[model samples]
Structure formats: structure tokens, C-alpha cells
Target: MKASTKNVIKSIAVLSVIALVCVAILSLANVFLKKEVTLDKATVKFLNEKFATTAPTTTGTDSDTAYNEDYFVMLTDGELSNASGYTYKSFKSNSSNYVSAIYYAQKGANEGVYYIESVSVGYQNPISVVVSFVIDNGDFSIQNIAVKEQREDFGDRKTQVLNPETFFYYVSLVKSDEDMNITDADIIAATGATTKKSVAGLNRAVTRAIDTMNKIYTKSDEIKAEINKRGGQNG
Candidate 1:
């Protein structure tokens, strides 16, 4: 065949491959379009699932969803002034660790428990997760991490940090975010996907939650900053 003819043939092949890839992507988009996943619904569903294993004990509340804002109060100077007396306090985040909101579980059997809501960036969109902490005698322990939203550019695989069998399984064994990143580095490596930014994003949020809780509960430097912010707001 002539060189020009060969070039034409190669162009055709390349076009065909591009067409096929486009079709495949469109097909996936169509399938995802068929299902509508809203953030609030997903959040509620995650909380419902988390609450199921929890026994109903809080007055006028029966499920884990009861831990919502209506059930728990936000932290104020009163709480800050008497921080030592309070074991848990909830506050809003200013994007620190990708955290948007943090709540304290003050209900029965849930005391010393905290819920940190992080909207971490994934491959393209944001991955919303609620990290829970169960503190005992000043020692904080992570418990049941609920990933409520995964709006990624590549569609939701729900396997990165959300994988319970692998990633989450290892995370469950970790007590602190530092341990998750350092002390239990082997475990995180064993879980795999730590190298991915989505996984790193999740880790960042978790670390922030753990660090924030530690600082808040222990009256760390963060307390001073938060107080200053709150004071400015009041002023």
C-alpha cells in the first residue's frame, strides 16, 4: 500500500478507537443518570445504617439520626469556659481538614462520642464522610466511619476509603489518625489505595477530626483560636 494510504488507514483506526471510548463513557453516564443520588438522602441513609447497630436510649430519640443538630447543641463560650467539665463539644469547622461540621454524641451510651463531617476532595468532586470518635478517659478511639457521598468524576466506585473489607477493615484497627498514617503505616499500606488522592483526602479529614478533637478536648492552641473567632463573632 502507498504511504498515504497507510496513513489514512491508521487515522481511521484511531478514530474508531476514540468512537468506541466515547460510546463506553456515554453508556456509563446513561446508567448513572438513571439513578439519582442526593447528598441529603445519602447522608440520612448512612446515619440510619450507623444508628441501626446503636440501641435507642436518648430521650425522644430512637435512632442514630438522633445525633443530628437538633439533638446536640453547638459549642459556645460557656462550654469553652468550662471545657474541663465537658467531655465532648460540637462546633463548625472553617474548612480545616476539609471538615464542615463536627458534632458531639452526648446521648446515653454515646457520651464522649463525636461525629466529624468532612467533605474531602476526590478525583474530581467532593467525598463527604462522617468520622466518629469514641473517647474513653481522655484516650480517643475511632469508630464506624460513614462515607455518605462520593461524587467523583469517574463515577462512584465506593471502594476507595469506603471499602469495608479492605481499607476500612484496617482503619478500624487504628486508634488515632497519626497511627493510621505512621504507627500503623503497614496496615494502611496493606489496605492499599493509600497512594490515591481520594484516600489521602479521606485520611486528611480523619487526621483533622482526630487532631481537632484532641485539641478541643485538651484545651490546645486551637481552643484559643476558636475562642478568639467566637469572641470576634460576638463582638
Candidate 2:
């Protein structure tokens, strides 16, 4: 072959290689810039349906008021204090305890993931629990909870029978209106009833209190299970 023809062929080959490299780079760039599309349509529809049914409707105009209606109403509406003057407060702070449900939609797609997050309260000695949920593809539900801190009135108790740990449990039950109200009921029932008052009446009272708290624990577990089920449906 002629030298000039060989040089021309080599140059053409180099240009072809450069063009191929440019095409490959552009293809990768397009992939990176492309929007993520959710592949699950049924799951997205289920989430939307579930949210429409379960989500609270708020009519308030103010941002804070709307937020309170949407998030804080459930936590505050229940009678946290009973006739015993016991009050229950969540260990999670206002900013932290806030529950938010978010929905993502693609520009041209009908389905996307939903995110939900909220705080749940639970108890342990010298430590209170706050749970945060992060549900992928649906709602953010409580994935796990951690011990935050002890109750506020951990050490201050007026009654000697009210040991700090047990007392906290007792007060929590009363505030939450759990079955622990039976503590006073059992005490009242046992009083003046000569059948069982003969031996260690104080021990019976303590036992009643402990039993009531145990009932609260059982109730709490039931509540947690329900929450988890709801979360699974979406998250």
C-alpha cells in the first residue's frame, strides 16, 4: 500500500475510536441524569389508598395549627392526667417527636415512594423510649426505638410506697389510664373485708400495683403490634 494511503487509514481509525468514546460517555451521562422511576404500581396505589383512609384531615390555616392538628392531636387528646394528679409526658422533644408523611412523585410517573416518620413512647427504668420509623417505598414507620432518658420526676416521690422505678410505672399507668386503676380498687375492696385483711395487707396493695403495671405493659405490646402492622402495610 502507498504511504499516504496508510497514513489516511490510521487517521480514520483514530477518529472512529474517539467517536465511539464520545458516544459511550454520552450514554453514561444520560443514565446518570435520567430520573428514577418506581417500578411498583400496585404498591404505590396501595400506599395512596391507605394514606387517604388513615391520614388525618386538618382544616386549620396556620402552619403551627395545622401541624398540631395533624401530628400532636393524637398525643395530646388522650387524658394523660387522672384524678391522682399524675401526668405523662413523652421523652421525645417537640422538634424530634414531630411526625411527617411525605409522598414523592415523578415528573411523568404516577407512582413513587412514601416516607413517614413519627415518635412513639415507651418505658424502661431510668430511661424512656422514643421510636423513629423509616419505611421505604411507602411510609416511614417506626423501624426501631431507643431509650432517651429517665422520667422527669425520677427521684421525687411523696409516698414511701412509691419507689422511684415502680412509682414511675404506677404514675405512667395512671396518666395513661391503663388497667392499673385497679390498684386503688383492689385496696378499697380489701379494706374492711375481714376475709383477706388478716395478713400483710400492704403486700397485697403492692402486688395489685405491680399487676396493674404489668397489664399496662401487655397493653403497650398490643399497641406496638398494631402500629407495626399498619406500618408494614405501607412502609
Candidate 3:
């Protein structure tokens, strides 16, 4: 009986050791594989909490690009104190387009930002993004595009073209006005999408964001009034 009890204790100890090793392996896997907020997932208040800060920007970011991750987080994050006292407003799309929702806010006195949400409709698996931007009165300046919910592959194509070196540079040459708008072909051109079949859904999705922002900035009576009240600066 004494021998049997000793054997049982030894077995239990061995089992406990194995169990701890398994747990350690799992913990390491989880730490390495954790995903970030709102990437490839629809924009939601819950998923966005993790994306509150911008990842250190990529290598190609232009010094003039306005993509302020903090401004976007501020626009979407209701918890943050609005030191600029920006009143939140929603602009709906009456036209037949994928422009889902639009949110605009002014930071302090002159700088303002737009959170234009759009979704890719025809993709096998749809993707979305908030084309966050600042309209420079001097020229077209895209601050940052708050990425979707776009898959890694297609979404990468969309931005690779629109990045500072490619799309912004290309637009600077063709544009005749300081208008904050883009043509459907702009994104298609940006991604270098080819004929027959391609990743062209992002074309309209991104355009919708820019178009919506322009409509509000240029046409909205209220926005004009507010701009005049603040001395008519687009920062």
C-alpha cells in the first residue's frame, strides 16, 4: 500500500508538469497572434478601442500627408474630451452609392477632419474603410485613410496606389482646383487594376469618402456658416 501511494503521487506530479508546459506554449502563441482593432472588421465602437493609436507610420508617408490617427480616434471615440468643442453630426447618402456614413469635426480653430465611411460592394467578401482626410485649400492633401475592415491583399493594393508617392503625386499633376474629390478611375489607376477582372471595388469605395467630404465642405450651408464663423480656413 505504501509503494502504491508513492507511485500515485509521482504520476500526479508528472501530469502537473506536462499540463504546465502545455499552458506555457498556449500563452506564447496567444501573445504572438493577437489581432488589432478594426482591421478587416467593420468599424464598430467595440473593435476600435484597440486602434486608438496610429501604428508608427509606414516608410512612404509624405511629410504633408494629413492622416492623423489621433484625429480619427477623436472623431470616433466619444469618450475623449472634445477640447475644440466639436459638435458631432452625421451626413447620410441619398444617392445610390456605398457611401455609408460621414462624420466631420473641426479641431480647435482651423484644422478639421472628415471620417468618411465606405464599403466595397462587389467584392466576394466586402471590405470597408474610413477615408479620413484634411482638405488643404492650397491643394489636395490626404492626411490618412483609416483602413477598413479590408482584407490584407486587396486593401493593400488600394492604399499602395493612394500612398503619398503614387496617387497623391499623380493627383497633384491632374487636378485643376483645390477641390477635395476624386474620380472612380483614380483608385483604379492607383492600384493599376487591369481589364476584365480586377480589384476595382475599392475605386468607388474610396471615391465615396472624398465626394461626401467635398459635398459637405463646399455645399453644406451649415458647414459654410461654421467656416465663416471660424474665418473660412480649411486646415
Q: Return the TM-score for each candidate structure.
A: 0.53, 0.18, 0.39
| Cα distance off (Å), candidate 1, residue 19 | 34
Residues 1-235, model 3: lDDT tens digits? 6999999999999999999999999999989986423312123331232223354322123212322322122222221113222222333233323555444444322235555677654345444656655566633444555545554245433444433345444344223323535454654565453321223445555566666555544433344344344342322
> Which 10 successive residues of model 2 have the least lDDT summed?
105-114
Q: Which residues of candidate 3, in runs, are more than 4 Å off? A: 1-96, 105-111, 138-141, 151-198, 219-235
Candidate 2 lDDT over 1-235, as tens digits, reads 9999999999999999999999999999988996332223432333323233123321213223333222211111122222112222322234323222222221111122222222222122222222222324432222222222334224442222222333333333333443334454443333322222211222322223233223233233333343344332322
The candidate that achieves the highest TM-score relative to the unseen native structure: 1
lDDT per residue, candidate 1, 1-235, as tens digits? 9999999999999999999999999999998785432224334334435533435332235444543433332345364545533332343344334555555443445544566666656555566677776666756666667666665424444434456567555456454434555433544465754436666566655665666666565553343344345432321
Report how far residue 75 has shifted in candidate 3, in Å: 8.9
Q: How many backbone clashes does candidate 2 have?
A: 4
Global fold similarity of model 2 (TM-score) = 0.18
Ranking by lDDT: 1, 3, 2
